[model samples]
Target: MSDFNSSVNLTMTINGVPRVIACNPADMLCDVLRSAGYTEVKKGCDTGNCGVCTVWLDGVPVPSCSVFAGRAEGREITTVRGVEKEATEFAQFLVAQGADQCGYCTPGFTMMVLALKRELKSPTETEIRHYLSGNLCRCSGYEGHLRAIIKYLEASHE
Candidate 1:
């Protein structure tokens, strides 16, 4: 007799909504999220090198590519869209400061920064850079990104 446990049913909260999905043992969270309509979770360098697929797993920032969908079965998943309201001001700052070039990696950067904002009341330049090292950008060259993050950090203190 064949085992029926190869694929598992996942019941997780996504963007504050209860979500139910089925995933195979080897399916990555990124693939499952995209399948479930969370396109904001980008698929960049699916080997976990790029942070484009970054998402919040129970309030912690993690690369969806490195995580299996089964791992999120009962946790809360927050994509960039989930935190759009919280990251809007920071996103605008990046745009106004000319930091959002090309815009491909902006969602990932925004998501990661939004999580950082939740964890830190204020972050130093070095800390910002360190925290953002995972997400790679080629168009903006990270100049505008760094500046915008600094400005966001400063503004939140006021």
Candidate 2:
């Protein structure tokens, strides 16, 4: 029998860097990443209702809080920091539209946006809203975020 509470080492490619991190089998990926100093992975609704702890798991956006750390072994994970250039560019639009409020959900939101940009060549407004439905922002009331995302997508295509 194996002890699930025992800590184990997992080698996961994080932000394009391979890192061996120690975590319990039961530990959530978000918690482990935060402990490993990836504070960008915020601790939100642990039930995966909130996308505040979103990260790229094998190039797909997933709620880290719902993922087991052990499952990430040998997998590629990309945080908002991994795509800093794109994140920064989007952030400018966010700021310009006054959508970068509180900044707690920015990282996860940015990750989703980056993925959306890569996945959708020319997403419609409905597609954009549908893609970002998982992420919630109380400060901006979503209007600002929608405006910023639309503007960012437009500027990026220009």
Candidate 3:
């Protein structure tokens, strides 16, 4: 294929299902994933400043927009939909705590929190806040999210 029309074929596992996608080598993972139907991977600040396009790449939380689709080949990609159970729980917690106001940034926040939970046993409030620093929530303040994370952590231990 000519350089201008070069399309790379990528085989990556998304949300527990293996998917193959063909796209330009320079296409960002966020665009590629959304095109492939994983709309849950929201596209906010495409510059990676807003963590709305967060996804778990090989079990590590990363901003999809900053990653190239070609780099994701042979990797495991987990969008918010992949962790339905956890995301749902986080959503419920957010609702209960009134943390889900605006809701646009919730998915990214949830994904980061889920990754934190998976990596840490019982993270402190400070740790949680520090870990989720990349995500921005302009509507509701972070108190509710902090409460929800603490509650979730407590419940997990019970």
Candidate 4:
């Protein structure tokens, strides 16, 4: 259609399923997911710094808020709600390590951790810390977060 940007059929594999959505071309992936009833995708800065809108775009962690819906026409968006297993496991680790305080940042941390785990499966504290520099935590002072992720990395491999 000539007015493709206004109303287009976009297709993407979200989490583990393929979905075709009708939306505006300029809509950010974060809004699309949230509008599609995936509130777990989150909406933070919407600029990419907060990392609160993090999601796996084509298997790589990305801030959905900064991504255009048109760009994800054929990509995959893995939100926390869809990746419950990994999120839950990470949540368990967060609890075990006493990482969670307010809990607003837990999902972002979980998504990032899962991505890191998939890549390294086991990373040192330094590596984990360096990798997570983008995500901001208001509670726990990152000490507990670091401990949990490291522990999760260690246990996920065991």
Tell me the TM-score of each prediction against the true structure. 0.93, 0.96, 0.94, 0.91
Error of 2 at 42 (Å): 0.7
| Candidate 2: Cα lDDT at 34 | 92
In candidate 2 the C-alpha lDDT for residue 89 amounts to 91
lDDT of 1: 0.85
Whole-model Cα lDDT of every candidate shown, in order: 0.85, 0.91, 0.87, 0.82
Tens digits of lDDT, candidate 3, 1-158: 45746887889899888888999858899999889888888888899998989999999999999998888989999999999998997788778777878788877888998998889888877888899999988797789988988888788778
Which pairs of residues have clashing backbones in candidate 3?
none
In what order do the candidates fall by lDDT, top score first?
A: 2, 3, 1, 4
Model 1 residue 130 CA deviation in Å: 0.7
The CA lDDT at 75 in model 1 is 96
Over 1-158, each residue of candidate 2 has an lDDT whose tens digit, in order, gives 97998998899999999999988968999999999999988977889988999999999999999999988999999999899999999999999988878999999999999999999998999999999999987677888898999988888899
Give candidate 2 misplaced runs (Cα > 4 Å). Answer: none
Residue-wise C-alpha lDDT for candidate 1, range 85-146, written one tens digit per residue: 77787888998788877887888888889888888667778888898899999776788888
Error of 4 at 42 (Å): 0.8
Best by lDDT: 2
